[model samples]
Target: MATIREIRRRIRSIQSTAKITRAMEMIAASKMRRAQERDIASRPYADLMRQVLAGLAAQRQGDDDIHPLLVQRPVNRIILIHITPDRGLCGGLNANVNRMAVSFVLEQSVPVTIVAVGRKGRDFMVRYGREVRAEFTHLGDRPSVVDILPIARVVTDDYSAGLADGVYLCYAEFVTTMTQRPVIWRLLPVEPATIEARLEVGYIYEPSAASVLAELLPRFVEMQLYHAILESIASEQSARMVAMRAATDNANELIEDLT
Candidate 1:
């Protein structure tokens, strides 16, 4: 057992930690609210974009009429865009994403490249000796779509240039304040099954159909990347808020027991 003076010092240290955790909890909560709202509000537009892309696929003809974005190819070289927090203190958020990403890489038969969207993801992959083709970090509490363009461009350009056969995104999906699930979403060679429900017929294009798709397909991809980043950030803040709240409570309990 510690002496009275030692116990008192320990209590003071815990109290200070509790104070910091509480502040972080409140800050994360505030940002989580905004991030969550933005994530939700953007869903409708995202859904519409998917619908349009599906409709374009429905318009597919012979090899000449198909858009390259919708063209399916064998998966040999793969790229995963992993999203995580720039900072720590969010319990298992980065760990969970990194685990899933590494699991994915391990399961693949060919070379896998990672496009890291935050410091944690980049650092983790680098430490494991995996290739990181592109990386973005220090995006702050909130980041706009413009900030995500380079990330989107890097992967899309690689896919277009045939440097990669498949593209994926790994991130945590915000289900609720206390629940976030890590998932892998394929971004390239768009899955027909996912958008089949939204497919429709009989739509005339203003310019040539191919011309219209050339303009819209890239934007569609960029939007999806932006949405993923937003979701990841929101989930990070939510997880951080919950973790901090728990830490504060645990500190309080410890202080009480010591007394």
Candidate 2:
């Protein structure tokens, strides 16, 4: 037993919080729609790019001169690009991605460094005593492919220069408004998806296959990274919207219970 005044005060505070969360839910819903559109729209192009890369990789199977990015060497040092949300109200989005990255790093025998793409991942990795090679944050709700080039350049330069042997990308993949999956995908050594020989169509490269590969490999890395970031954004917005909606509903339920 509580007095009438104390119960009234508690209800007021909860009502205020509910109002704020409702507003956030609306904002997140708006942003989620845009992010989902961008993420979905880019998937077809990414798939086609992978198919093209697979064909080019097949063409240079026996050649002595393979692109440096496509050369798979012994993994002595590994780089992980960990992407997460900067803010935390998105349920388990940050925790799920961070947990996946930590598990990956622990499982690797070689030295694993991180190129953190958001504040949450960077802070968690730094706190976990993992080596952070680079940090990128505040990329905003919508980012262009050009915005991701520097990140791609850093990893590509490191791999080409032998500073890193393998690169992995960790992010949340948006499936539906209620679902997001944490994924750790390989980014370096340029492993193109396997294609059947019968399905391959022979196309003439403008200059040479090697030359085309040289141009496309870096672009491929950039596109993959850009798409992953977009997926993470959409996932973050969806998770936040759902989380806030839950909070608002819980608050209302509590109010009714108290009354």
Candidate 3:
């Protein structure tokens, strides 16, 4: 059994840890608010872009020309786009995402190549994934498309080149401060339904609908990825903030009991 001195030492260690966590929590909380505002602010532009793309896609169905991204390819090899935190200490955020990604891999029959976007995802896929094609790391806080563009382009390029038949992006979709759910979103061979829902507006194409789609499709994919990264960063901050607050509360409770 540990003596009172040892217990005191342990408490002091945890106290120090709690202090650090509390500071981190405050920093993350401030960043989270900013991220939330940015996300909300960007929604209108994103939605409008989606609507425009959808209309373009719908109009192209009747035309002879169609964008390559909309063309369905035979199932052969697959690309799994995985996203996770660069650091730890935020409950099971990374673990749960990893679990879902693993489950997805296990269910797949075709050969898969992983394109990991974070250290946690990269490490987990390296250990577990059947095949890891590429790994990216060191994505700092407050990421942008420029940071994630190269990775996204690689995945899309492989799909376009017939190297990968399809692409599935996996990430933790933030639902609430207390809830984040793992999601496997299809990225390649863009879903028609997804386009149809937003094609409410009509437009007159300058060159052609197909030409417009060809240019817009890749940008859409890249922007979507950027959005996901921003969301995950915000979710990480929120989760960390909550976790730290709990730790501080527990420490306070222990101090009260001791006194």
Candidate 4:
């Protein structure tokens, strides 16, 4: 029911939108490559750290000798660390993660606290009336280990002090440049079985087993949190790139249909 002139004007508007999305897609693609590099580069160190800690845990005599980081406790207070993009135009990445966080809060039996590492998640949790214990953002596309330490410390300290019973980290796991899946991973109360599954066994420790664990266990925890941030950023960029391409495609299709 629209005139040809009106349709042509609409097409011009869509074309402009398509150009913006195209530019965004290119920028996101560039960032995604850098992020993937960082993720790949750090993976080996993290894996080796896990193996060393697992071997040390195995060397110990009894259950009580296990590191405090590996202890599982009753669910009294739950802490969720959510990693999301500070900005939008990333398709459903932010929405998907926030939905999971809200669902977790509603489903938990004990007190639930959210530690949001991105602005998007923080705003959503606060608007939805979910308890946000802590928030960090403005880390930019490329973040270093020191940037996320504050967030990691809060959960680690709470778990160590017996203030929080469990800790969960929510982020998107990278599959491919075009496909990313949101994942909820258990961060604290590291299970021996899980570690042992991937663990390389029968390694001699240089120092006392106790000393090795005392030092390495904390590093493993920090590395896990750091890598998680990388994964989140990569996934966000990938999702954004894919989404923008789709938008541009849809716009082009509409232009053709109108013509």
- The model with the greatest TM-score is 2
Model 2 RMSD in Å is 1.9
> What are the runs in model 3 whose C-alpha is more than 4 Å off?
1-14, 62-64, 196-202
lDDT against the true structure, per candidate, is 0.86, 0.91, 0.81, 0.86
For model 2, the superposed segments whose C-alpha errors exceed 4 Å read: 1-3, 193-201
lDDT per residue, candidate 3, 1-259, as tens digits? 9788987887787778778878988987897877777678767777777888877776667555656677786898889989888889778889998999999988989988898888999898877635788888888877666788898889888877889888998888878888878889888888656864555445778787777778888988887887787788778878888888888888877866654
Clashes of 4: 0
Per-residue CA lDDT of candidate 2, range 1-259, in tens? 9999999999999999999999999999999888878867887777777777788888888789879898889999999999998899999999999999999999999999999999999999999899999999999999988888989999999999999999999999999999999999888988754432333667889888889889988988898899899989989999999999999999999999989
TM-score of each predicted structure versus truth: 0.92, 0.93, 0.90, 0.90
Model 4 is weakest, by summed lDDT over 10 consecutive residues, at 196-205
TM-score of candidate 3 relative to the true fold: 0.90
Give a tens-digit lDDT track for model 1, residues 176-226.
899889999799966645774454556788876677777778888888888
Model 1, C-alpha of 234: deviation from truth (Å): 1.6
Clashing pairs in 4: none
Q: Residue 175 of model 4: what lDDT?
A: 88
User: Model 1 TM-score?
Assistant: 0.92
Model 2 poorest ten-residue lDDT run:
192-201
How much is 186 displaced in model 3, in angstroms?
0.6
List the pairs of residues colliding in candidate 2: none
